[model samples]
Target chain A: MAEKPKVGCARPTGGLVGQPEARQEQQTSQPTKEVRTMIQVGKPAPDFAAPAYHKGEFTSVKLSDHLGKWVVLCFYPGDFTFV
Target chain B: MSVDSVFVHKMWNDHELSKMVKGGVPFPMLSDGGGKVGTAYGVYDEGAGVENRGRFIIDPDGVIQAFEVLTPPVGRHVSETLRQIQAYQLVRKSKGTEATPSGWKPGKMTLKPGPELVGRVWEVWKTSMEAD
Candidate 1:
């Protein structure tokens, strides 16, 4: 079967080029007891995280890191911004 | 929306999202409650906890348009999203003649560039960067 790069975790995320899920498995667990609002068009954007692109490369970027600053957590589900 | 959220990927501490932040992505990408953003955009599958691909055009007024959620495993295009922005911008500048065609780069062919195209927009998209 052709392996496609999975955008999120907990699945095969079969793309051969993706950062192996085994890597992130070492730290942190799932968040619970919170709605973790995914879509907020008008309200203040929620705080959440994922290893993100920083300085022209992927690094550990957390929302708490930007506490007191402005940030736009524009989330996508797949490769290269959707398409 | 004074504050906006745009998530192109999700890999907390993984190489991708980390690269984005380190690479000067200029934004933070929150988790979607196991794809909650997709769910909010009506694109997440309750069983899979992933998302469908779609363009959610939210006006600064906080109204949603073109909020079309996509199907399983498909992807979206940045250029297409840019086209939406282009379309919004054109409409704001006045009724122009540019529809922001496919692969429409900025400053490219916009409605053949001619007169008599009053109130006839070709590439007018909306975005938050617009002036009030």
Candidate 2:
């Protein structure tokens, strides 16, 4: 018998070495209605650091580090799902 | 970027999108497993449990110059994005002196920023556009 995966909290636990279910649990929360405030343009982009899979490895990337260069922050849905 | 973890990103790259891109994607695909970035960007689609395909262009000064948030099932145009970035770069280099016109590209005419060009831009740009 196999154990069920644990749910992840609000932050990443670091690195790429984690169970699929636990890792995915973070983004799979059920949607609810709330007043949504839009992040306005012409303002400083919100900073973030996350484990990014680039080239052939998973490295931590931060938005502040690219301060002196152009940055394109794109967000898509989960991988392996139909777009 | 995908909402999956780095581990899942690796798996998807190694097994899926990598095959199409040959050596693999050239840019960093950040993982937003916790949806914080998406929430901050206001692109998180809570009902669908996924980010709503957001693309933001940030300047070197870290200010967002342009952005687009599209629903899933609509693919983005890489060429248009490239053109936009180039336009932004051109404008930044001009230091508020020039503005990129429609369908503007490198070597294309840029309108000078002044009160004179406001109402009379068509007279100057019409010939250049007809030549193209």
Compare the candidates by TM-score and give the number of the best one: 2
Q: TM-scores across all candidates?
A: 0.41, 0.80
Per-residue C-alpha lDDT of model 2 across residues B16-116, encoded as one tens digit per residue: 88888888778876777656567667887766768888999999988999999888888788787888999999899989798988768778888997877
Of the native A-B interface contacts, what share survives in model 1? 0.14
Chain A TM-scores for all candidates read 0.38, 0.54
Question: Model 1 Cα displacement at B54 (Å)?
Answer: 3.2
Model 1 CAPRI quality: incorrect
Q: TM-score of the B chain in model 2?
A: 0.91
Interface RMSD of 2: 3.4
Best by DockQ: 2
Q: Could you tell me the lDDT of residue B28 within candidate 2?
A: 72
Spell out the clash pairs found in candidate 2. A74-B1
Q: Where in model 1 is the C-alpha error above 4 Å?
A: A1-83, B1-14, B18-24, B34-37, B95-105, B108-132
Ten-residue segment with the worst summed lDDT in candidate 2 chain B? Answer: B123-132
